[model samples]
Structures are given as C-alpha cells and as structure tokens.
Target: MLDPDRIRVVAPHFKRRLSGVTSTVVQLIPAQRRRGLGIATLGPGLPETMPALSFAQLPALWKKPKGAAHRVWHARRNVEMLAGIVLRDLLRMPLKLLFTSAAQRHHSRYTRWLISKMDAVVATSARSGSFLKVPHTVILHGIDTDLFHPPEGVDDTIAGTSLPGEHLIGCFGRVRHQKGTDLFVKAMIELLPRYPSWTAIVSGRVTAEHKGFADGLKADIARAGLSERIVFLGEVDDIKPWYRRLTLYVAPSRNEGFGLTPLEAMASETAVVASDAGAYREQIAEGMTGAVVAAGEYEPLRDAIEAYLADPGRAHLHAKAAVAHVRADFALAGEAAALEGVYSRLLGVPATSPQS
Candidate 1:
C-alpha cells in the first residue's frame, strides 16, 4: 500500500477485465516508480504487488501532497476520466486530471466533452492524436527489451506443446475478425504446403461472441488438412517466451489502437510482417526491420510473408536489426521518462532525475 500523503500521481484501473489499458498500467507504474516518482495505482484488477491506494484513501485527495500544489490523476479510459472529473469538480479535490487517448477513430460527443475537462492529454501515437478535438501530446508506447529479448540458444520447441516445424510464424491477440485472424489462417493455408518447414501459431482468447468465428477458422484448417500445421495456443499466461520461439511475427489487425505486438516481436529478435494498422508503420523500418502492407489486403499480406519464408537469411538479418531499432527508439525506460515529464508539468513540479 502507498501512503496517500506521499502519492503525487494516481493511475486508476476501473475495469476488472484484463485489457490493453490495464496492461499499460501494470508495466508503466514500476518503471515510473524507479524514476522516484511518487505514483501509485487506484482501484481493482491490478496485481497486489503494485503500489496502490485503497478506496478508503480517496478522501486524502482533498488535501495536497507535500511539496506539490495538486496531485495528478492520470486516466486512460472514459470511466476513469469521469471519476477524475467527479473528484476534481463535484467533490472539490486537489487534482489535475490527465487522459491518454489510444483510439484511432473520431470520438463520440460525450467522450469529447469528458476529454475537454482534462488538464492535459496524451495520445499513444500521432494518428491517435489527430482524432482528438483538443490539444494533445503524442507518446508512443515502448516495450521492456530485457523481458522480450532473443533466446540464448537454438531451442525451437515451445515448452509445453510439441508443436512441430523448424520455422514458427505467430499471430497473437484476440481471435476475432477485427484482428484479421482469418487472413493469417487463409495465408497459412496457401503457404504451409509449399514450405513444409514452417508452421503457424495463433494465440489469444476467443470470447463467447466470437466462438463461432474461431470454430469456423478451425473447421477451415481441418478441411485443408492443415490442423496439425496451424496451431492455436489459446491465450497463454506468459507471451514473452512465445515471441522468442517465432521466426516471424505478424500483426494483421484490420484496425487497432496503437498496437504493440510488432514491437514486442521485434524486441524478442523476431522479424515482423504487419498490416498498416495502428503504429506499426512508424515502428517498422520497411525493408530493414520488417515489412508493412495495406491493412485488410489478403494478396499483399500473403506475398510479404512469402518473401520472408522464401529467404531465411534475409529474415535473420532483419531480426538482428529489429533488436537494435527497438532498444534505440522504444525502450520502456524512455516512455517512463517521457511520461514523468508530462506528470511534472501537470503537477507544477520540476521533473526529478531518474534514479540510477
């Protein structure tokens, strides 16, 4: 538990279900704490190990923390933004509200009204920022290179599953149409027979609403006699190691909110073939690190993946370059430092030097 008096910033995760916002909060809080920022999480769903302020501590926000005029309330979701508004406006708390937007589409009028109340705004990417009607700063998300690095030895098999094939290709995330899982499956069906050495892995949850869609994909795989070659891991707890097992990682999402899979795969020393969705094009260096084709285009996606599958040496070269690119531009530490700057400005305090 964090002392309410010591907390200079509060990150609230209201949603009980695990999501991208929740994941971001879980990864970022520790990095910010390492920089000596007096930040803590509020609400449920977050790991108990995280520095957190209880609901009982909500009253403490009425008073300012030591050496700061006001506490920064950083909200990533709309409900969290509403909570900040209630506390700062209706209840009269000493808080400066901040909201980070990741949505790439036009906002609803209600959402825009809520955003207008924020003291500061952050967009996860330039495209995300363009959708905002208010002033905002763009801060791209980064990955933890130490956690997602290349494997030490030549171990191809995944720990628990006896999945075959020397070269593994992966597409991870929700098994829904929006994620373009079908495109990956269709492409695999066409290419897997030609390249006997390669296998495809699809890992992610299939919700009740999308169970039929998932079943349909499986049936198609069965019909093609490629069920064994195309495997669905179905949402593993630890995905970092899975990234390390792949020769190629594909993010074929038809739409996204600043996707991070490409960076995760690249950080794990695996080359990527991604659709031009989210911030993938910004992250991947076309021919050097990975290839980015038009989103939702089947033929182009198939051809791009074939290029990497056809030439192993080129893929290996790109994988090597990817590690360097992510470390130089998208390390988690850099994001922590950048966000600390945002918090500092909102709190009207000088940004503290990151603790060594």
Candidate 2:
C-alpha cells in the first residue's frame, strides 16, 4: 500500500510488483504535486471482455489490418478499441509508455506504433529499445533491494562446496520452451552422476499444450535416473530464499531483455551461470559476477556448470563480487529517481523545485 501523497500505477501481473518502487520515489520528490501523477497506460481491454472504446478517438485509427478488420474494424463496429486509445490517450503530449514488448505479437499494432511516437521512452530492458526502434533510457527494471539484500557472513552459512554440499543447480522461474528447461534436463542427465549431490529444482507451472512439456520434462528427469535429484516446486509466490538456497542460478533462455533473475540472484550472493543474453553482458562479467556461455549449446552449457562445480573458490569470489556489483548499480531508489528525472524532463520542469 502507498501513502496518501504518492502516485499509483495499477499494473497487472507481468509488470513487476511496483509498490516498493513507487513508494520510495514519493519520499524523494518533496515538492511533488498534491494531485500526484496522471498515468497513461496500455489499455487493459474493456469490461465484460467486450471491447469498449471512447467515441471521440475513433476517427484517429488507421485502417484495420486484414485479420482484425472483422472483429475490431470500424463502420459496422460500434467502437474501434485500438483507435480510441491512440487518439484519446497517446498523440497527446508528454506520454510515459510503460509497455511490455514480450506480448507485442498479441497487442494491437496501432498501440505499439503509437509508443514509438511517445515524447520519451522508458524501457525496462535493452530489448525494449530494439522492439520500438527507439534509443531508450534503460531503467533496468527495479528490484526491492531490501527484499533481495545479500545475507551477512553468507559464505559461512553456505554449505555447498564443489563436493561437500548438496549439488543443486536450481532454475528459478517457470518451466516452458522459452526457458529451455528441456535442455537443462538433458544437460543434467549428462552431468548428475559425476556429481551425486546435484539436484535440479524447476519451479512454476505450465498451461494447456505446455502441460505436455512439463510431463515430458518429468519423464526425461526420471529416465535419466535423476528423478530423485530433479524436484519441481510449482508457482512459488516468494522466490528470494530459493535463490539463497541454491549453489548456482541457471537461466537457459534463448532470449532475455534484462533478465532480472540473475541480478536478483547476484544480490542474494548466488553465483550465476546464464545464457549470454543482452542484459547479462551488462551485469555479469565472465569471471566476475558469474559466467555467461552461449545460449542453447549443450556442451558449452555443461562445461560452464562443470567449471563452477569443480571450482568453489572461483564461484565464491564471483558470488561475492556479483552482490556488491549489483548493489552499486542496480539500486532501486536510484532508478526511481532517474525515472522521476525522465518525467520531469517531459514536463519542462527541473527535478528540484524552482527555488521553492
């Protein structure tokens, strides 16, 4: 919950829980307006799941694409949902586009096109810029450092050694194709016997056809004789402790904008071994924060994991460096302030009040 004077952004599930972030900025900007902030959002469709668009903005829409023309087209259609948002909200001055390109294939092109026309772009990741074809100020999605801080004397409490502790290489997010859990399972079969203590815990659920993927994943794990080693903890609401518990964090995705999972693990002081996704390059130095290997190559993937397992001293050094490195650059309060600066620039107002 936020304080009375703060601005609120009602985000749906995919957008991170912004409560911790929005609240912090309210304290920093002392002269902020009493009315707080006015938000311009990507439309959340309409009530009754029937598209309802405002009458005034209907004319501003471009001709419907051949596919959606039947469903959202004008003339016979009472309200053109996509058009209404473009004309009504965007195309107005001073817009802050808080969008997710991850679902661009599903969103109306007119809406996506309109964002490229925004006064300024604040993308959560580097991919946002590429998707929009705009030079975006990478805000590097905010994390509540308080919730994800490194534990004290963490090295002492950590039981995992190359051989001493349980050999658990955990994947923190959902088990889906994009995540490449199938590949991880294959790699585990090749490596688990060499390190008996190793376990692969894949958390989160699958839907519809992807449910088949989960079943196949389990079957693979069982076939490899590592079923005892492969544990699935589905849909965890809190993932911080899971980071601390793991010997290393694995991100095998073919794509990532600014994979926050690695950064979060770094903050928890977990040594990370991730795909060389765009953002990972910015955060994890090869032998520093953690190592980054080419995405989707099984042999290299196995080597990176084996390298870490074989050398606890290097992993420990990288883990400690990762926590310290992220804390310096990825601080949430600092990011909120930078976001505030972007907002201030749009309003032709300086960040600090004009001499009160």
Candidate 3:
C-alpha cells in the first residue's frame, strides 16, 4: 500500500517500453530521494526500489499535504502529459503540471499541444531548446559517476564477457543505422587491419527491426577477414567494466537528444571520440578530454581513432582529464538538485538544499 498523501511530486511514465526517458527516470528518482524530496513514480517498467503511486492513489492529490500548497505532476512523454492534463483539468485534481522535453527535432502538432498545457518546461540541452515552441530551462543530462568510475588498474579483459583485446574501442547504444553503428564499423574496418594491436567492440541491443542491419555489419567485418578483430558482445548487465576496459569510446550517432555515453565513458576515465550529435560537442572539451567529429563522417572518426591508437600516451592523459571533467561538471546529484529547484518553485515551496 502506498501513502499517496505523502507524495509531493509525481513523475508519471505511462510508456510500457524502456527507453532513454525511462532510463532517466530510473537514475533520477533515487538521486531525488537522496535530497529528501517526497516524489514517486506512477507507471510500469520502473525498478521496484523507486516509490510508485497507483490509480487508486490518484484521488489523494485532492487532499493536499499538510502545510504545502499543491502536488506536482512531472511528465516526460506526450501521453504522460495528457494524463497530467486530464487529472488536473477534467478530473479536477489539485496538481501543478510540469514537462521535460528532450527531443532535438521539431515535435508533432499533438506533442506541441500537450506541451502548451505544461505550467513549465525543461529542455535536456540548449540544442534541444531550439526546437521547442515554448521557452524552456536547459538542464543537461548527467551520469552516475560512482557507478561508472575508473578501474583501480587497467585490465585487458572485459569483466562480464570473454571478449579479449589489447585495447578496445567501443561504440555503445542501440545497434542501428540511425545510431551510425555502420560508420563505426566502417572506420574500424579501414583502420583495424593497420593497427593490429587495437580491436573494436560494439556493445548494444539490436532490436527486431534492426537485426538485419546489425547482421550486415558483421558480414562486412567477416568479408574484410577482420571478424576476430571486431567483436559484437550484444547486451550486458554490467557496462561499467566495459567502459573501464576501453582505451577509447566512440559515439557515432547521426542524431541524438542528449547523448550520455561520452559522459559515461569519461566518468570511467576513458578517452572518447564522438560524433557531433546532440550534446556531444558541448559535453567533450576538444583536445583536453576527447575529440568530437562531424556526424555521419567516417574519415574524421577513423583519423581520431588512429591518432589515439598511435599515441596512446596522449589518450591516457585525456582519459585522466575526462575523469576530472565528469566528476566536476556532470555529477548526477547536480542534475537532481537542479530539477528539485524546478519542482519546488512550481509547488511554492522553498528550494531543497543543493547536493554535492
């Protein structure tokens, strides 16, 4: 049984499938809890540790918490936005509506309409704000530095898998055409033969629709007789060790909302070579932490990888800088505190004390 009366903030996630938005909610709620915020989720596909409010608990919003004004309903999806509107307007629930936008492209008319109903909006990055019809506060995404930190000492083997390589260049995320997985593969094919010391790894899930695309890349790797040099480890439960084991991490997505892989790699003290998609350019300090290349271009990515492989000393230095950069600038607690401010303002409550 949930004590809905204690809920001060409601983060609704109506979508059943796990996606980037879902991942953010999972990572965020725990951090928000650490700040002593009375927030909870209301949806499927979320971890059990996070507090959740049921449909029966919906009526509890009408009974405001002692001394507080109104509860807040934060939505991340169009459907979730609609639900918030219905509860506040149609059902006459006493709740303030909030929405966070992360799409980098123009939204559909329905989406725009849903956003128009929001009391306030949050954009994941400044680039994403350009596509928003309404003004939004830009709150960049952050990774869990504690979970994805540098290894005690560098290791050759990836902990979860048997994939062995002297140096691993990783391309992580969904394995699909849009993600520029092919570009990463092409770059690897052209350069791996020359740099016999380094191997490339693609670690991600290939959805049913993109299984053929993933298979095609494997075929190309085989045709080049470099199949052994390029490995596809599918999806793993633990990704920290993979990032920790990598000499360099590549994010070749053609487009992104606010790519977090580079930050994850940086947090793990690994040098990165990422396509200028989403917030990659802003996240990376060129020549200091990592290098950002033109999206969808294979030559630039190839050259970046080659340069890193040739002079690994430079890569090691950048990796150290990346770890420092992430710890200082991209802490998850910072994002959670920023969000808490937004929620507190909407509820007419004092801002929570900033977390470290």
Candidate 4:
C-alpha cells in the first residue's frame, strides 16, 4: 500500500509474461525511485522489488498532490495508453498521459490513433522514432552496470550450475525462430568441433508452442556429436553473472524491440557478435566493442564467431573497450535522469537537483 498523495508518476504494464517491456519496467522503476522520483507501477507480473500501486489505490489520482500540477501516467503499451485516456479524458482525473514507443515498424491504425491522444510521447530508439506519427523524445534503454560487470578472476563459472567450459559463448532470449536460435545452433555446431577449448550455451525459456523448435536444436547437436560441448541452459534465475562467465556473446535475433542482451554483454566485459536486428547495430562498434552480421544470415554469423575463436587476444582487447564504452554512454542513472526531466516538464516542477 502506497500513499496516493505522494505519488507523482504512475507506470502501468499490462503483460504478465516477461518481455523487453517488462524488463525495462523492472529495472527502471527502482533506479527512478533511487533518484527521488515519486513513481509506482500499476499492473501484474512485476517483481516485488518494484514499487507498485493497487487498483484500490488508483482513486488517489482523482485528487492531485497539494502543490503539484498533475500526476503523470506513463504507459508503454497501446492498451495501457487507452486506459490512461479513459481515466484522464473520460473520467475527469487530473492525470497527464505519456506513452513510450518501442516498436520499430509502422504502427497499426488503432495504435496510431491511441498514440495521437497522448500528452507526451517517448521513443526507445531513433529507429523506433521514425515509426511514430507523433512528436516524441528519444530515450535509449540503459543497463545497471553495477549488477552486470566483469568477474574478479579468470576461471569464472556460471553460478548455481554444473556447466563447465574453458570459454563459453551464449545466445540468450526466447527459444523460437524469431530469435534466430536455429541459426545460432547451426553456427555453433559447425565451429565448436574445430575449437575444442570453447563451448556454446543457449539460455532462455521454450514456450509450449516452441517445444518442437527447441527439441530440434538439441537433436541437431546430438547428431553432430557435440551435445556435451553445446549446452541448453533453460531460463536462468540470475543472468548477470552468466554474462560475466562468457568469452563471447551472440545475439542472432530476426526481430527485437531494442534488445538489451548486447548491452548487458558489453557491460559484463564480454565481446559480442550480434546480427543487425533491433537496436543491436546501434549498441556495437564493429571492431571496437563487437562485430555485427546481417540479420537471418547464419554464414556471416558463423564467420564472425570463428574469427573470435581463432584470436582470443584480439577478442579480449575488444572486451576491455566494451566495458569502457558502456560505462561512458549507457548508465542506468542517466536514463533515470532523462526520464525525470520528462516528468518534471510535464508537472512543471523540479524533478531533482539538476543532473550533471
């Protein structure tokens, strides 16, 4: 239970499943609160770590804070946007509606119509901004550098697992076709045989619908006689440390809404080889931080991984540069500060002591 009077921002998430949007809310709200912003999430599926409001507590929005202008309701989904419009426009609540757009392609007519009614809009990336029909601010997502960083020693193992390998390469996300899991597996099967020192890992959930797809990959690994070297670690409880254990990280997705795995990898001091899917191209710097291959093309992906395996010294240099790149540009606090400015402007008050 939270004091309705103290709340200045309400962020709503409708989906129960863990997704890119859900990940953003889970990571951002805590950072926002740490910066002294009075914000709370209003929805299901969020972890206990996030500050949240109950449906019963929402009536507090009917009455604005004593001196504050109005409460800002930030929505990330079309359904949530419509809910905000109905609450503020139709129900006469003193709420300002702001929607954050993450879709990279054209929006549906219905989604565009809903966006048109927002008081303000935020795009997750410049590419996503191009698809938005409304005037918006571009705010890229940031990772918690503290939570995901390089390990202290050289022999780092993925905690809570018996998996062992000298060098671990990984592809993490949903185990489905759209994520290009098949492509990653194909590349690993071809490369792992020659490089006995390195192994590959695929970590993510396989929905009941995608069970066949997951099973096929496992069968392929067995047929290639590299089943022991190529492991499938289902969804992990703590993924940050897993990144620290990796020598090379791969993001071979066919589509994404500004994927964060590459950023997470770079922050962990692991070099990456990602496809030109989602915001991955924006995250990596060719030979500096990591390499990028064309989306859906496994041949180039294979070549990139092979190059990294052949030259571990060069890859280590890139990994060190990656750590510096992420620290300089993508801190979670920076994202929280930028968002505070948005809320401050909407409410006509100081969000915080001006960020540096």
Choose the strongest candidate by TM-score: 1
Where does candidate 2 stray beyond 4 Å?
1-112, 125-131, 152-165, 352-356
Tens digits of per-residue lDDT, candidate 2, 1-356, equal 22211222212221222322222232323222322332112223322222223334333233321222111111101122233335436543122333323221223566556554444555555554556565556666545567776655544233522223454577866567877787777777787778775666777656566888999988887877777677777878767767776667888776654557887788887889888664676667678878788877778877888887777667778888988787888866555566656655544444533232
List CA RMSD, all candidates. Answer: 1.3, 9.7, 1.8, 1.8
Off by over 4 Å in 1: 156-161
Global lDDT of model 4? 0.89
lDDT string for model 1 (1-356, tens) is: 57888899999989887787877888889988988999999999989899999999899889889899999999999999999999999999999999999998999999999999999999999988999999988899988888889877655334434887678899999999999999999999999999998889999999999999999999999999999999998989999888888889999999998888999999998999999988889899999999999999999999999999999778889999999999999999999989989998988889988889
Candidate 3 C-alpha lDDT tens digits along 60-81: 8889865578888999888889
Query: RMSD in angstroms, candidate 4?
Result: 1.8
Candidate maximizing lDDT = 1
345: Cα error in model 3, Å: 1.0
- Order of the predicted models by TM-score, top scorer first: 1, 4, 3, 2
Select the stronger candidate by lDDT from 3 and 4: 4
lDDT of each: 0.92, 0.56, 0.87, 0.89
lDDT ranking from best candidate downward: 1, 4, 3, 2
Ten-residue stretch with the least lDDT total in model 3: 154-163
Q: What would the per-residue lDDT of candidate 4 be over residues 1-356, giving only the tens digit for each residue?
A: 77878889999988899999998888888888888778899999999867899998877789997569799999999889999999999899999999998888899999999999999999988889999988999988898998888877744554434665568889999999999999999998998878887888999999999999999999999999988888998999988888888889999999888999999999999999999888888889889989999999989999998999998777789999999998888888888889889998999998765323
Instruction: State, as a TM-score between 0 and 1, how close model 4 is to the true structure.
Output: 0.96
